[model samples]
Target: MTKKRKSRGRSKGGKGRSDYVECSNCGSRVPRDKAKKVTQRVSLVEPTLARELSQKGAYIPVSYVTKYYCISCAVHYGVVKVRAREDRRTSYNS
Candidate 1:
């Protein structure tokens, strides 16, 4: 049985304001709490990521598709299977 990985919760670090909030992609400055209100928390999983749980199993979260915004997480309540390359190789061999 595989253990489920939990989301990384935000740190309400002491009152010192953030130095700057930058876009995860473009590095452009995002308004305060704007990044906080992102569209979705895109999947950070990859076969090579050491910490990633098995991508080939039935337990994978469906949000791996649409954005997984922290606050609006329920938007993608349905989960779809995205085949990982690791599992795809079996089809070719079969």
Candidate 2:
């Protein structure tokens, strides 16, 4: 069979199996390695209030919200971009 991606679209190299995560947008079950994970820092205080608190030397707390998206949802949400045939084999971070 012909292959489209070297990793078969998953990052679980040499691992037998990976856990599944639900897509935040679609609620679909997808492999943890295959899903697109997005982490966002959320401020507990409003931006204006946070700024004011910061000026007063008050400590403002922030939380990290992690979201997972399936391939379809990721593409729909613009989390991942479709690449050309040649570009598909190249790593974006390289």
Candidate 3:
């Protein structure tokens, strides 16, 4: 049978198994490198309030939230899109 998808790369010097991470949306286990990682800033204060505070020279606390999604969830959430045969080989930068 012919290959369905293009190979990412050769694992020439890799170890046996890889580390896994839990998908934030579906709670499924996915390989760390294969998972889609997303980082978002969560603000403790409301956006309007935070803007007012900032204008007043007040500090607003924000937290960086990181989430990982499996391939299924990533596609479902529009994080990635199905590409054409020619576009499939292109790599994307976050």
TM-score winner: 2
- The digit string of per-residue lDDT tens for model 3 on 1-94 reads 5543444521222565678999999999987777888999999999999999999999888899999999899999998788777776556551
Candidate 1 stretches with Cα past 4 Å from truth are 1-19, 34-36, 39-57, 61-94
TM agreement with the true structure for every prediction:
0.22, 0.88, 0.82
lDDT of each: 0.37, 0.90, 0.78
Can you tell me which runs of candidate 3 are displaced by over 4 Å? 1-16
- Please state the error at residue 12 of candidate 2 in Å: 1.1
lDDT string for model 1 (55-87, tens) is: 444344434332223222222332222346455
Pairs of colliding residues, candidate 2? none
The 10-residue segment with the lowest total lDDT in model 3: 4-13
- Model 1 TM-score? 0.22
Better of 1 and 2 by TM-score: 2
Per-candidate Cα RMSD to the true structure, in Å, reads: 18.7, 1.5, 3.1
The list of candidate 2 runs beyond 4 A from truth reads none
Evaluated at residue 25, the lDDT of candidate 2 is: 94
- Count of backbone clashes for each model? 3, 0, 0
